[model samples]
Target: MDYYKVNSKNLSLLKERVSVPTYDRTNVKAGILHIGIGGFHRAHEAFYTDELLNKNSNSNWGICGVALLSFDQRIYQTLKDQNGLYTLIVKELDGTLTKTIIGSIVDYLFAPENPIAVIERIANPEIKIITLTITEGGYNYNEATGEFEIENPSIQKDLKNPNDPKTVFGYLTQGLKLRKENNVSGCTIQSCDNIQGNGHVTKKMLLSYVKHAEPELVSWIESHVSFPNSMVDRITPATVSADMAALKETSGIEDAWPVVCEPFKQWVIEDDFIAGRPAWEKVGAQFVEDVVPYEKMKLSLLNAGHSVLGILGTLIGYSTIDEVVNDTVVSAFLEAYMEQEVIPTLGDLEGVDLNEYKKSLLQRFGNIYIKDQVDRICSESSAKIPKFMLPTVQSQLKDGGSIELAAFVIASWAIYSLGVDENGTKIPIKDAVKAVLHEKAVAAKSNPKAFLDIESIFGSLADSESFVEVFTKSYQNIMQFGVKKCLIDLNSKF
Candidate 1:
């Protein structure tokens, strides 16, 4: 099979199989500057922006993507090679593929190649919104202290020499400083990551960086800029070699960096853009006055559900989300956790039917076509649990809701972090605090308090006698009965 390479020239040829951009690519201008051009960004925000461009006469909302670190050089090169054009393969629940050529990305700048271009792009008066999908840990926030870590080596280096910046905070400081100097209007700095109150978090972290670097710019940023909180949801798995081959087989187009995601995607943003914005609502993006409830609901249900399944699934030798979700015991456990444990924490989410959402979440997670990897969900659980699951645990602790399921989830994570499953197979752990987690998990075998003692993740939960009691019992149960037996027992209780 001769597969045509994906580029601007081959869009016409590729359009025979996949939906190509209807908007004039030449006329598309970059109004939005996005950092971290990862799979989730492409599948969610960029997908919505593409729809907006297709429907609206306004073509100024085209995205200009940025790749910050040296490791991101491959994606930078791929996007640049394809002229910022790539294929998005949507895996529908009914075993259908919806392929589209996404051209919303008008430009891509690799920060490592030329940092000046990135700074200048941010300074461009036309660039209104500077969005980010730099993950939860990328914010340079110290979870334990609830403060930005100024002494991070990259931040320190960038602070010492702001001209050649390395960190996002440094780049943002220099760019916003230039914008101020250039008399460019302020724009919205939106975060598309899954953090609760992301906009407020971003504003605080950025201000913390700028205050230490350039105190003069602090007032300008506060008065000129607006940071809008957002709740973004999509199950976008990392693209593998098999996806490329699949694209070649189905669409007959060879894409260097194509993204694959489930059909369902959602973005709820606070309607607080300082500069002019696009009518993304036309393409199904909800603009709300307050995104907190939605964020709470999503993080507590979908995100935490992934963690729960991923930890237990990996422990039970299941490799993908669909595989684990297909198991009746695992599925029932998840349903109980969402209904009994998580839902109570999320007080009223306006215009949302919680039961329907929970049912849809199971369907999304169980989409066999999507093949969302368990390891991907299991990765960085140290960062994910605190943000996604533990909040529910905390809320449940305060309200006297059942924390049993959440406790089991935490215990599963601690056991999984030990780098070995029940069958003695080495479970490859990927976390920033892998060594610490392993050491603590090892220490926790005798003293369960050792694991809870990690003040950053567990916080004050270790002090709660009820939580500690349940958590210790859960940990011991998992060690004795294994994942499947324990899950069956837990589900039977529900």
Candidate 2:
């Protein structure tokens, strides 16, 4: 077995498997049209589809990936290079690693290069479910108001011609309009982003676009489309030269595009597709009537847990989640934050064991092999904080419980927004509020109210006495004593 020939090796492995899965490549048809072709999608959704295809020979769940942004051309070329084949390396905490080739993505289309072709494919009746992982920011909606930003150039163009626009909502609207015109059965639009009530968020953005662009079409879409909420989890890290080298060494396959993720993966989706869906349950996916509790549990706890480590981890100069989890101080902070702050705030969801979930989350975080980056998790904190952390903070405040850790997290954001870590190293702050955050931080150096004025980031919560006191106090503490001293103080106080 000449492993240097990685593609051949993969093909041979695929052939040797007893259940040589085969799809009606001709009649299979595109049942899933996915937006934002990224590493997470490859590790998560594409993996699920591969499993389904393996179980059922006649399954028609082939995916046609549409990359909306121009920079994604590199990814497009990489996937195309390998005939849409790639390996998902799932690294376990206990030094165990497993790799599998995902083959669900049947084709790729760059929207900018061929918008009409992409639109026509989505318009096709064959695409039963239009799934998205376009990131929370991709929707281009104002988080505080939950309304589409009409001022956005993309939104403006999308409004002018719903049939042809650059944005995802525009593409979806245009596709749906074509579907309605062609009398094609309406498809389910599933959002796989980490936003709370993500499906609703996506629906709102799409509907908002339709409202201004085509009012009658909005009604038709409202009646037809099913945007099922989903809670997706996986600690996938960005691929770098190290990852590529590791893949080449292990498999003797020089994969230009390989995805590295933790062994733990989860997909809890609402079973609400119109033209039917795969028995994903067979492939370790959970299909439930209400994904709310599951989503809340995952988002507020697991996802939020990751964010907690993300900010603190970066401040501590740790590169990965595993490093953060292994640090005694970081680990203690997370455990206390989860048990005392996060869990107490969460209302009981039927059939969910909060204790068990928290334990599992800790275990997952401790997985060293995952090598999940703090920076990656910390990206888009402005959007992520509201979904993952603020809800818990809000609930805890309402219940009269102390929110010391939550306050610390918020303060950490304020500190991070200053664009430098404790060591005076430049901390690359990645958020929509990046530009204005520095100015706010400077002004707030004299008065905390200046920081609170960023309504988009803080929402109405910043005005509240409870949040204001804690956030301001913590920010002051960080300024006076620094991150480590503040952490020590928080450990003592809370």
Candidate 3:
């Protein structure tokens, strides 16, 4: 197979190999500016927009992708080189792969190279929606305090250079300022991360960041901007070299970076666009007045499911999520955890069937072809625990229900941070609070309460005696019997 790079020029030759963009490249205008072009953004947000373009829904709604961090430039350069075209290799549970060429992104800019270009892009009145998938950590938020880290050094620098700023919040305020000065309409800001009440948090943080950095812009921002809460779900594994290699070998299209996700994709967004939005619902997106029910369903069930087993997968030396979920004991443990703990906390959703959703998630997690890394899922459990896991504990405790699995997840997170797995192999841990977590993990070896006392990670759970008792017991069980045996023990007990 000849190595035909995916681009507008190679569209004809690679048409059968991968789905090509039907809309004329030149006619597509930039109407949406997406922050952080990562695997999830490409797989979920960009995929949906690509489908909308396929239906010829709106030409002005094309995406302008932006990269903020230094590492982001590497993968995004491929999109730029190929004229904003990339491949979506969707994986099925039974080893089927669907190759798609996504062209929703008409243009891309690395903000680190030139911030003004991105600023101008945001200031444009035609750009109505500014969506972000910068991840939970990228928000620069403290989950415990619900506060923006205003004291961050980068933010401090951005505070000094408000007009030519560095952070996302800086660009938001500065661009909105320019828009106001130019008498243009305000744009909607959509957050598509795993956080609960994502849009509400975005608005709160943006307002808080600017209140001190650019005080004058606060009221105008409050009146003009709209941050609609949204819930986006897709099991997009971080693209690896092998995925790219397979894509090229199979499709004869050499994509520098291609996203591989499970075939399941969903987006439930609040209908609160400030200016206007694309007809995404035409392509199966759900728009509701309140996205809380949907948000709870995803965060508690799907995300919490990943959270509960992610560290156990890492600790037991399972490389990918498929292998973890494939284990009969681990699968049974997850099934019991969801049924007895996580599901009891969720309210009845109007359109969604919770039981069916859980069944689908098990299949999604067990999709071997997708190769979702356990370390990737386990990575930042300190931050993730607050969003995906802690809420379940809070809700379960409120109802006076079982919290054994929730406690076990937290226990696994603490022990996993010790930088060594059960086999005594060194594990590289990544987190926003790794230093604090490491010290706590070490301290917890002698006293389990030491780890639970990390108020930022556990919040009020640290203050609960019953919660602490269960968590302490779970941690001790893992220490004595190892994660594998304890998992079996938990499955049988639950």
Best by lDDT: 1
lDDT to native, each model: 0.91, 0.80, 0.87
Better of 1 and 2 by TM-score: 1
Q: If ranked by lDDT, best first, what sequence of candidates would result?
A: 1, 3, 2
Judge candidate 3 against the unseen true structure and give its global Cα lDDT, from 0 to 1.
Answer: 0.87
The sequence of per-residue lDDT tens digits that candidate 3 reaches over residues 370-464 is 78888888788777888987888898888899999888878888899898999998888888789999999999999998998887667767888
1-494 per-residue lDDT for model 2 (tens digits): 33443242356554442122354333445689999989999999988888788766446788888888889999888887777777777786677657676778888888989888888888898888989998878878876787789799878876776555788877887788888999998889999998878888888888887888777898888888998889999878898788778766766666788888887789998888877776788889988888888888888888888988888878767788889888877777777888888777667778778888788888888887777778888888878887888888888888898788888887777777777777777887888768888888778788766777788867888768877888888888878887777776667755
Q: Per-residue lDDT tens digits of candidate 1, residues 1-494?
A: 56899899988888888899998989999999999999999999999999889885589899999999999999999999999999999988898888999999999999988999999999999899999999888998776667898888899999998888989999999999999999989988999998999999999999999999999999999999999999999899989999999889876899988999998889999999999899999999999999999999999999999998899999999889999999999999999999999998887777899999999999999999888888899888878989999888888888988999999989888889888877788998888888889999999899877898888777788999999999999999989888899989989999
Report lDDT (Cα) of residue 371, candidate 2. 76
lDDT of 2: 0.80
TM-scores, one per candidate: 0.98, 0.95, 0.98
lDDT of model 2, residue 93: 69
Task: Provide the clashing-pair count of each candidate structure.
Answer: 0, 0, 0
